[model samples]
Target: MKNKIFFLSCFILLSLTSFSQSISSSPYSLYGVGSLYDSDFGAIPSMGSSGIALTPSNFINNLNPASLGFMPLNHFMLDVGGKAIATTYQSSSKSEKRNNFQFSHFAFAFPVTKKSGFSVSLRPYSSASYKISDLKLPILDSNESYYLTAGGTGGLNNFDFSYGYRFTDKFTLGISTALLFGNVDDNRTFTILNSITNIHKKTDYNGFRATIGSQYKIDSTFTIGTTIKLPTQIKSSKVQTVETVADEVLSVIESNTPSDVDDYYMPLEIGVGISKKFKKALTVNFDYQKSLWNDTRQSDLYGDFVNQDRFALGFAYLDEKSNFRKYWDRIQYFAGANFDTGYLEIDGKRVNNASVSVGINLPIENSLSSLNISYSYGQKGRISEGLIKENYHKLSLNLSLDGIWFVKRKIE
Candidate 1:
C-alpha cells in the first residue's frame, strides 16, 4: 500500500510543474505542448515527430477506448516517464541556448469487471513558461544598467477518468472525459527587490472523448483490429488575476478580482487507426488522423498553432525468450515514421512547417515500459529557403514498477 501511495504522490507533484523556463514548439501550441507535457507523448522519437500517433494497440493506447480493447490482462498497469531537454536557437542578430530537466508524465490503468476496464491519468495538457532579461543601458551614456527577469506558467493540465467495455468477443468500446485546470506563477527579480506573484485561474472544461473498435482473429497466423474516435469539446472559465510585489508589500492591488474574459474551446480530431499481426511477436500498426482545427479557431482558446493532419508509423519487437508479455511475442520492440503539416502564427502570418521523425523501442524486461529510449529529428520548410526551417529533436525514457498479487487457491 505504501508503494502505491508513494507512486501516486509523484503524480500530484508532477502536476505542479515549472521551476524554470523552456520554449518547445508544437504543431498545436506554436512551440510544443508548452512545457506542460511531452509535445509528442512518444509520438515522435526524434525531430520529425508528427500526427495521430503510432500507439502500440495493446497496453499503451488506454486513452483511446478502442485501444483498451487490446488489453489481455485482467489486472492493472502503471506507467511513468520523463525527459531532459538541451535546446539551442538562432535567427539573425543573436543566438541563445538553455538546458533543463522537466517532468514528463505518469499514468495508471486497471480493470473494473471481467470485460471492462478503467483508467486515471494525470498529465500536463498545455503550458506557458517564458523568461526574458535585458538592461536598456547598453551604450546607455555608458553609465549604468539594471536587469530584470520574470517567468510565468499557464494553460491546461489534464486529469481524466475513463472506462472501457467489451460488448462482444470481437467488439470493444471506450469513453473518457477530462477536467482541465490552469495554474500560473510569476517570479520577478530586479536591482532592488525579489518577489513572487501567483496567478490562479481555474477552468472547468468537460470533454467527451470516445472510441469504438473491434478485433478479428483469422486462424493463428492473422489478426486485425480497427478503431475510431469522435470529436471532443472542452469548455472553461476565462478569469485571470495578476498580483504584483507592491500589492503584497503595500496591499495596493485588488487581489481577488476576476477578469471578464470569455470562455474558449480546444480543437478536436477525427481519428482512425488499424493494427495487424503475424505469429503474435511480429506486428505492425498504422494510424491516420485529421484534427479539425478550423472547427474551433474562432472559439478556440488556443492559438493558431493547431495542426490539421498528423501521420505516424509504429512497430515493436521482443527477444523471443522474454516472458513478461502474455502474447506469443516476448519482448516487444518497434520503430516508425511521421509527417505533419501545420500553421504557426508569429507576426500576423501563418508559417507552415512540414516535419518528419522516426524511432525504435527498447524494453527492459518486456513490460508496458522499460528503460526505453526513443529519438527523432525533423525539418520544417516553406518560407525562408529550401530548408528554411525548424529542426526538431527529442530523447525520452520510460520506466515502470509492476507485479501481480496472487491469492493462492487453498486446497479444500
Candidate 2:
C-alpha cells in the first residue's frame, strides 16, 4: 500500500508541474511586485497557515525552520501542493468573476544527524498579473480626465535553503536563506482628448534575504516559537518603449531603451507562535506576525506603504485510540481562521483581508503519509469610491509522503 501511494503521489506531482506558471490575477497585483503569494505546505494551509510551533516528526514545516530539528531519526519527507481560486471583483458600478488554478510549492526534508536536519524548497513569492481597461481619472490640476488601459504579467520566485540544529532536548535554532528572482512585463495606454500615448516596460529583479528562528518546548504538550526576517533590497533594471499619436501622425519618443530603476525594499518582519495540546486528542495553534513596512519608506505611484499585522488561529482533533481495523479512526480534522491588516494604503484607506477555513487529512497507509484537502472563503479590500473589493473562495490540495532509511529488514 505504501509503494502504491508513493507512485500515485509522484504522478500527480509531475502532472501539476505543467500548470505551475498559471497565476491568480488581481487589480492589487498592479502594485509593487504583484500580489504577495501564500505557498504554505502540508496541513498548514488547512490550519490557517499557523504551524510555526509544530513538531516535524511526521511532516515538514515551512513556517519555522527550527521545527525541523525535531524530525524523527532516519525519516525522509516530501510535500507538494496546489490551489484553485474563484474570485469576484466588485466596484460601485459593476462586478466581474474569474477562476484560476496554480501550483503552490514543492519541498523535501531529511535528518542530517540525530540532532540536526536540512531542507530545500521552490515556490512563487509573488504574482503581478492583472488587467485594467478604460479607467477614467482626472488629470493633475485639471478638471479634464484621461482614459487609461493597462495590463501586466510576471512576478518573482523563491528558492529557499534551511538548516536546524537542536541545542538540547527542549531547544532548537535554525536559519534560512532565500533567493528571489523574476521579471515583470507591463503595457499601458493613455488617451487624453485627441492625443494617445503608449508605454511598454519589462523589469527584472533579484535579491537575497535571511531569516532566523528558534523554538522552545515549555512542556511535553506545549511549545513556543519565534522568527525574525531581516530587511533587504531588490535591485531592478528595465527596458521600455514609448510612443504617441495625434492628428493622424505618430511619434516614437523612445524605442527599447534600457535603464536602471528604483530598487524595491523589503522591511523587517517578526512573528511568534504557540502550540498547545489538550487531552492528547485535540491541539490548538495560534500565531501573530508584524511587518514594519512604514520603516521601508516606500511609496508607489498609486499607493503608500504602511505597517502590517497578521493573525491566525487553528484547532485540530483526532482519535487518541489507535484502531488498525478502522481506517476512519486515523483521520484528522482541522479548522482555522486568519486576518490581515495589509501593507498597502490607497487614498488613506488600508486594504485588509479576513478568512475562515476547514479541512481533513486522509491517511494513505499505516505511515504518516496522507492527502490534505482544505477550503476557504475570504474577503479583501472594501467597497468604496475609487477602490475595489474582492470576495474569493479557495481550495487547497497537498500530498505528504514519509519514508524510512538506513534500516535493514530482519526477514530479508
Candidate 3:
C-alpha cells in the first residue's frame, strides 16, 4: 500500500510536469475549445466511453461522479493514461495525413466513509492544433498574390474535484467542481509574394465549470445514471501584429499588444445512461448525451454552433476467477459503437461523427491492478460542398491500480 501511494504521487507529479504534444489535427477543432476530449480516464473508454450507470468496482468511473460512492471501503484507485492519434484529411482536390502522441488523463479516487467517496482528476477538456495554408488572389488593388495561412494551438485543461454520497442502498448523488484554464493561440497570417509584409493575429482563453450527477440501482444487475454540466463563459483577449523584413533588417508594427475581444461561451450538457450486469461476467451499457450550444446563442467565426447529441452502446466481459490454467480467461474484452451529431454547422450542413471501438483489460501478475488498451476508428465531416472529410484511428493505454490503503497491518 505504501509503495502504491508513492507510485501514485510520482505519476501525478510527472503528469503535471511532462510536456506532452497535442493529439488532434481536425479542422473542426477550430470551432469550440478545439476537439473535445471524448475518452475518460480508464477502461471505461475501451467500453465505448459509456459507464455512467456502472459502479466502479475495479476501475475509476469519472463519467458519473455519483458512482464514486460505490467504491469498496479502504480501496484506493489510481488511473493514468495516454493516447496516439493518426488521421487522414481529404478534400475534392487533395489529401493529407497527420499523427500525434499525447498524454490523456490522470485520476485518483477513494472512499471517504462507508457510504461516501471522492475523486480528483486532471485532464484536457479540448485541444486545438491545426495548420492550413493556401494561395489567395491579390488583396484589394494589389497585383501581388499573397499567402493565406490560418492555424491555432492550445486548449482547455480541466482540474476536477468531486464528492459522492449514498442516499440509500440504491441511490447516490454527487457534485463536481472544475477549474478550467488555458491559452488558445489563433494565428492568421497574410504574406505578400514579393514584398516584406506579413500580418498576424492571435487570441487567448480562460474559464470555470461545474456538474451534477446521480445514479440509481434498480436491482443487482441494473442501474441508471444522469449528469448535467453547467455552462460558463471564457474570457478572451486578442493581439494583431505586422512585420516587415528587408536587407537583413526587421521591422515590427506590434508585438504582444493586447486587443479587445468578446468572451467565448461554453455550452451546457446533459447525459443519461443505463447499465446491466449479468452473473458477474458480462456487462452492457448505453448512453445518450446532448450539448445545448443553441441555448448559448454563440457562433464561431469559422462555423455556426448548434446543438450536439451523441448515442453509444457497449459491453464488457470479465472473469471473476482468473482460471490460472487458462490465461485467456483472465483477460477482459470490450467493444462498442457511437454516433454523434456535431455542434458545428457549415453552409447549412451539420458535421457528424461515427465510431466503433474495442479494448482489453489484462490483469497484472500477482495483483488486482490491470493494464487496459483500446483502439478506435472513426470518421468525421463530409467531403461535399467544399468541406473536408477526416478519417482517424486512435489508440489508448491506461494503468489502473486498485488496492487497499490506510488499513492496520499485522507485523510479524
Q: How many residue pairs clash (N, CA or C atoms closer than 3 angstroms) in each of the candidate models, in the order given?
A: 28, 0, 0
lDDT of 2 by residue, 1-412 (tens): 5467557766765666667777999999999899999999888888888988888466789999998898888999998888888999999999999988888998999999999899999999999999999988878899999998999999999999999999999999999999999999999999999999999999999999999999999999999999999999999999999999999799999999997688999999999999999998899999999999999999998789899999999888886766756877888999999999999999899999999999998788778888888899999999987689999999988888889999999996
Per-residue lDDT tens digits for candidate 3, residues 323-405, read 75565677889998888998889878889999899998876655567777899999999997447899999888787888889
- For each candidate in turn, the TM-score is 0.66, 0.96, 0.87
Query: Candidate 1 on 1-412: residue-level lDDT in tens?
Result: 3345344534533532342234343222323223324433432343233222232322345335444544545546666555555544443344456554555556666666667767777666766665544322222365554454545555556776767677766556667766666544444444323553445443333444445544444444344444454555554443445555643573224444555643444556556555555555655556666766566554222235455576666655444445644433333445667655553443344444433434444333334443345665545443321112345555555444444434465885
Clashing pairs in 3: none
TM-score of 1: 0.66
Between prediction 1 and prediction 3, the one with superior TM-score is 3
Taken over the whole model, the C-alpha lDDT of each candidate is: 0.48, 0.90, 0.81
Worst 10 residues of 3 by lDDT: 8-17
Off by over 4 Å in 2: 1-15, 322-325
Cα distance off (Å), candidate 2, residue 247? 1.7
Best by TM-score: 2
Model 3: C-alpha RMSD to truth? 4.4
Arranged by TM-score with the best first, the candidates are: 2, 3, 1
User: What lDDT, from 0 to 1, does candidate 2 have?
Assistant: 0.90
Question: How large is the C-alpha RMSD of every model relative to the true structure?
Answer: 8.5, 1.7, 4.4
**Candidate 1 deviant stretches above 4 angstroms:** 1-36, 39-58, 132-151, 184-257, 278-281, 299-307, 319-332, 343-369, 379-392, 406-412
lDDT of 2 at 104: 91
